[model samples]
Target: MKGKDHFLVAGRITWDFRRLSEEETDWGNKILFLPAAKNMSMLVVESSPWNANDFGIPYPTYFHPAKDSEVFEWQERMRSLERKWLFSFAGAPRPDNPKSIRGQIIDQCRNSKVGKLLECDFRESKCHAPSSIMQMFQGSLFCLQPQGDSYTRRSAFDSMLAGWIPVFFHPGSAYTQYTWHLPKNYTTYSVFIPEDDIRKRNVSIKERLLQIPPEQVKVMRENVINLIPGLIYADPRSELETLKDAFDVSVQAIIDKVTRLRKNMIEGRTEYDNFLEENSWKYALLEEGQREAGGHVWDPFFSKPKPGEDSSSDSNGGTTISADAAKNSWKSEQRDKTQ
Candidate 1:
C-alpha cells in the first residue's frame, strides 16, 4: 500500500484524546458517518486504545457517534473533531510517531508492574516492524483498546486480528459500531466500561478487565483470528482493499486521494497564513494584553513564561513555555492517581 504512496495512518490526534476527560463519563449514543474521499483507499486507519484489543484495519474508517462520548454530546464533539482530524491528517505518516500508544504500551508491558503479572521476563520487547507489534498483541489473551483522540483506536484491530477480545474503554462506542447487533457485555465477543463509571462507582478498570471470563475471551479470540486475514493489509492481487470492497462496490472505488492530500498539505498552510493575516489585529492586541499582565498568573502552562525564564525576550532571549515544558509538568504516575 505504501508503494502506491498510500498514506496509512494508524494513530489519532493526541491533543483531542486528552480532551475527553473534560466531558461527562457516562452516556449511550449513536452517530451517522460518511467518508470524504472515494473508496477510502488512500488513508486507512486502525486507531484503538492501549488497554483494548483491535485487530487490523487497512481502510479509511470513521466512528460515527465518534469516541470519548457518553451521550449525544460525544457525537457532536466528534463531528467537529473529525474535520480537523482524519481529513486534515491526509498525509500523516502511518502512525510512525515515536510517542505512539503502541510503543508506550509495549514499554509498560516490559516494565515492573505489568511484567510481574505476565510471569515473563522482559525481552526488550521492541519490534522494528508493524508485524512484530501485531505478534506482541496476538500473544496476549486480551488486547487493550483505548480510544486516542476522541475515538476507539488501533487496539481494536490488534485484538480482533489476534483473536483476543477488545477491552473497550469508552462507553457506548463498540455496540454502536455494529449497529447494536453486537452484545456490549462479555458474552458475545467483547467488554466495555463507561468512562465516568470508573471513579464514581468505585470501579477498578484493570481489575474489572482482568476479571473477564476466560471462556468468553477464547470465543472473542476465535472471532478475531478468523477476522484478521481478510481485514489486514496483505493483498497482492487486489491491493489491501478486499475486506471493505467485499461490503460494497463503493468501497474499492479509487479517487486521487493521495494527490489531493499532498495538494492540501500545501494549500492548508497558505490558508493558515491568510487567516493569521486576517486576524493579525486581534493577535497583536492579545500579545499586548499578555505583555501587560504576566507571571505565575492564569496561563502558567501555555501563554505564560517558564518558571525560571523571562517572557519579554523573543525566541532567542525569552524564556517561554515550550512543548517540553508542558510535558515536564506532570507530577504523578497516571495509573496511581485517582480520578
Candidate 2:
C-alpha cells in the first residue's frame, strides 16, 4: 500500500491497529492511504477524537440523506414538535463500572420531575427501537449524550434529527469528533457539561438546561436542525443535487488531505515527520493551546495502560487496544499469510 492512493472505510468497526505487522505499520506511516477506522494513524478519518493525521467523521445515523425539499420538510417538522421533557437519557447504567457516570445520570433523570429516563438493559427492547428512541428525543428539549462504549454515539445525531440540543459530557462525544459536519462553536448547537461534573454531582442536568434562556435554546435547536443535511449519509440510489451529506464531506476532506500530503512529499517537506505521528493528538489540538498545557482532557481516554496493570479496562471501558497483544496478533497473521 506504500505510495498508493488507497482509502479503507472501516465503518463502525474499530480496526485493531495492533493487527498490523511491523512492516505493514511502517508502510502505513510512509504511505498516504486513508483508513476510516477507530485506530489513530497518520492518515485516518475516524469517529474517535481528532489527531494530527486523523480527521473526525460522524457515526452513521438511522435515516438516509434526503433532498433539499425533504430535509427542509423534516426541519420544519422538528421545529414544530412539542418537547414536554426538559432533558432525557436513553441508555443503560453501567452500575458495576465505578468510573462511569451513567448510573448517576440515570438516577438524576429518574429523580427529576422534568427529566425522562429510558433505562435500557437486557430487558428493555425500547432502547433498540429507532421509533422509540426518536420519540424520546422528539419529546425532549435536550438529550443527555454521555459517551457510550465509545466516545461518539449515533444518538447524538438522532437527537439533532429531532432538533433536540445534545448535552455532551465530554469533548470526544461531539466537540472534537465531527469537525467537518458540526459547528466549531459548540455552544451554538450543543451544551457541554463536563463528565467530571456529572460524576461529582457538581451540576444538575435539568437545572443547567433550564438556566439557558428560552431564546438561546431556540437558536441552538435551530442550529442543530440546520446541520441535519451535512451530518447524514446520502441515499445511494439517488443524487442529492446540491447539498453534501456526510459521505461527500468526508471524501472531499480525504482528497484534500491526500493532495496536501502528496504536495509536501514532492517538495520534501518534513512537516508530518515521525515525531508528529507519535504525538499526533497534540498537533491536532495545537490551536486549542493544549500543546502548551502538556496534555488534553481526553488524554486519559486514549492513553495506554501502565506496565503490569490489569489491562482489562481503561478509562473508556476496554475500547482501546493493547500494544503487545496487537503486535503478537499481527505476527501470527503474517505467519499465516506466509503459510
Candidate 3:
C-alpha cells in the first residue's frame, strides 16, 4: 500500500479525535484517523486542518450558482446596494465557554453606533431565515466571523455570497483553511482581527475597520464578490458552463495534488516519504520556504500553551492542536510501523 493511489472524501465535518474518549481514540488510531506520512498515497480531502498531503475543501454554502451571467448580475446588484452598517455580526453568545469572544463581540456591536448585531439566541427566528440573513449581510460593509463550534463557519461563505467582506478572528477560520477557494493573500479578500485583541479589550473593531481607506475597502469588497462564483455549489441539475463552482474548484485541486504526489513518488523523491504529516499545515500551506523561513504570519496565533495550561488561555481561543503533541503522535506512529 505504500504507493497505491487512494482518496478519502471526508463528509461535511473534519474529524479531529483529540478530545474523544479513550475507546474512541483507540478506534480512530487503528483506522488512521490521525493520518501520518505512510498515508501519503491516500489523499484525504476534508474541511478541517490536516496534513499537507491532504486537501482542505470549503464547506458548502446555501448559495447555489446557475450560470456566470446570473452570478455577475448578482455581484453588480450587491455592489450597488447601500451599505448602512460599517460592520455586523450574527451569532449566539456562548456565555458558558470562557474562551469564546462572542459575548464581547455582541456587546461591542450593540454599543457601537456604526455596527449592527443580530443575536442568534433561542428567541431570534430571523437568524434561521436565509433571506433575513442575506439582507443583513447585504446592508453591512463587513461581517464579523468569529469561531463557532468549529473554526470554520458556513456564515463566512454566506457573508461572501452577499458580496460583503468577512472579518475573521482566527487564521484557522479562513487563512489556513479553504486555500483552493479563497485568495492566498487573505487581506485581498478579508480582514483579520486577532481574537486575543478582542479578549484583552485592546482593540476596537469599529475603529480598526474605519482605518481602512474607502478605495481599499472597495477593492476588497470586489475581490470578495468575485469569489462568490467559486464559493457556492452550482445546482447539479443545471450545468454552469461559464464558471467553476465549489465542486469544480475542489475536484480540480484534488487532481492537481494527486498528480504532483504521483510524480514525486514515481521520480523517487524521498523528501515526503518520511515527512512528518503533522507539520503539513506549516510546511505545505503556511510556508513555502519551510525551515529556512523566519516564520509565517499566522505562526503567532498557533503557538502551543505551556504544560498544565489550557490552550484557551493563549491568544487563539485554544482551538488548535499543540505542535508538541502532534510531533509526538507522529513519532509514536512511526515507531509502531517500524516494530
* RMSD vs true structure, all candidates: 18.8, 7.2, 7.7
**Which digits, one per residue and each the tens of the lDDT, describe model 1 over residues 30-128?**
110113222232211322122111112233222211111222342233223211100000001114323223333333344423321121112232322
**Residue 12 of candidate 1: its Cα lDDT?**
25
Which candidate model has the greater TM-score, 1 or 3?
3
lDDT of 3 by residue, 1-339 (tens): 353355555443343323244554342332334445336422222333443444666667676766777778888898899999999999888676677889889989999999998877555358778888989999999999998665667788889999899999988887777777887788998898988889886589999999999999999999998888888888888888878998898778767766766787788764343455444555545445334323566666666567788766565663444232333334434644554
- Give Cα-based local distance difference scores for all models: 0.33, 0.67, 0.71
**Pairing residues by index, what is the TM-score of model 1?**
0.36
Give the per-residue Cα lDDT of candidate 3 at 291: 45
Off by over 4 Å in 1: 1-128, 178-187, 199-202, 233-236, 239-339
The TM-score measured for candidate 2 stands at 0.78
Ranking by lDDT: 3, 2, 1
Where is model 3 more than 4 Å wrong at Cα? Answer: 1-4, 16-19, 24-54, 270-274, 286-294, 305-309, 320-339
Model 3 CA RMSD to the hidden true structure, in angstroms = 7.7
Query: Residue 68 error for model 2, in Å?
Result: 2.0
Candidate order, TM-score descending: 3, 2, 1
Distance from true position, residue 65, model 3, in Å?
2.3
Q: Of the candidates shown, which would achieve the greatest TM-score relative to the real structure?
A: 3
Q: Considering summed lDDT, which 10 consecutive residues are worst modelled in model 3? A: 41-50
